[model samples]
Each structure stands twice: as C-alpha cells, then as structure tokens.
Target: MIFELQNDYIELFKLIKVLDLVDSGGDAKKLVVEGLVKRNGEIELKKRAKIVSGDVIEIAEVRIEVKG
Candidate 1:
C-alpha cells in the first residue's frame, strides 16, 4: 500500500496507526519495539522514526510505501 505524506514526515508508530495496521498507537509501538517493523530492509526499533518519502515500511505481510 502507498501512504501519501501530508507533512515532511510521519512517525513510524503513527504511520502504522494511521494506516489502521494496528488497533492503536500503543499496539504500533509494541510492534516496533518487538522488532516486527522494518524500515527499508532493516529492523526499525524506533517507534518515532521519521518516515519520509521514498521509504518502505514492512510489518508482517504488509508493505507500506511512503510518498511525498
């Protein structure tokens, strides 16, 4: 899926929550802390990692592409 960024960037956890990938922000944070989320191709442990355009985030079987 593709997420169109309205600002310069969006927090990783917020992105997940905004996309409805999880039930809430806390769930999204848990996913990140547990190493279930990836930025580009590496495991992203930062719940508030800045997600900007051209970045790809993966969680479970879902792939979200950020676009400016």
Candidate 2:
C-alpha cells in the first residue's frame, strides 16, 4: 500500500490508523506495543516514531510505503 503524506512526516500509530490497518488509535498502539509493527524491516516500538517519505512500514502481511 502507498501512503501519500500531507505533512513533512507522520507518527507510526497515526500511519497505521490512516491506512485502516487497525480499527482505532488505541488498537494501533496495542499492536505496536506487541512488537507487531516494523519500520524498514526492523521492529518499531515507538508509537510516535516519525515516518517520513520513502520509509517502509510492515505490519502483519501488509507493507506500506510512504510517498511524498
């Protein structure tokens, strides 16, 4: 999936929500806390990690690319 940025960057959890990966921000947070989210292939635990254009996010069997 591709995510077009509306700002300079987006938070990790917000990105998940924007993509409809989870039902709510709290669900996104829980997923992250469980080490279910990956940033550029590495486990990402920070819910507010700044996701910029060109970054890749992976969750479950889905992959998302952030585009400018």
Candidate 3:
C-alpha cells in the first residue's frame, strides 16, 4: 500500500488511523504501544514518531509506503 504525504511528516498513530488500520485512534496507539508496529523493519514503540515521505510502516500483514 502507499500513503501520499501532504506535509513534512505525519505521526505514526495518526497514519494508522488515517489508513483505517484500527477502529480508533486509541486502538492505533495501542497497536504501537504493544510493539505491534514496525518502521523500517524495526519495532516502533513511539506512537508519535515522525513519519516522513519514503518511510515504510508495517503492521500485521499490511505494508504501507509513504510517498511524497
């Protein structure tokens, strides 16, 4: 999947919610809190980690590529 970036960066949880990966923003944060998300192939624990264009996020079987 691909996510077009509209700004310099996007928060991790916000991206999850924007993509409808979870039912709610809280759910999206929980997904990250539990170490269920990966950024650039490594476990990402920060829900507000800055996600910039060209970044790759992975959750479960979903892979989202950030494109400018």
Which candidate leads in lDDT?
3
lDDT of 2 by residue, 19-60 (tens): 888899999999999999999999999999999999999998
In model 2, state the lDDT of residue 55. Answer: 95
TM-score of 1: 0.98
Candidate 1 per-residue lDDT, tens place, 1-68, comes to 99999999999999999999889999999999999999999999999999999999999899999999
Per-residue lDDT tens digits of candidate 3, residues 19-66? Answer: 998899999999999999999999999999999998999999999999
Error of 2 at 1 (Å): 0.6
User: Where does model 1 exceed 4 Å of error?
Assistant: none
Error of 3 at 25 (Å): 0.4
- Each prediction's RMSD over C-alphas, in Å, is 0.4, 0.6, 0.4
| Candidate 1: Cα lDDT at 65 | 91
Give per-candidate clash totals: 0, 0, 0
* Model 1 worst lDDT window (10 residues): 19-28
Model 3 lDDT, full chain set: 0.98
The model with the greater lDDT, 1 or 2, is 1
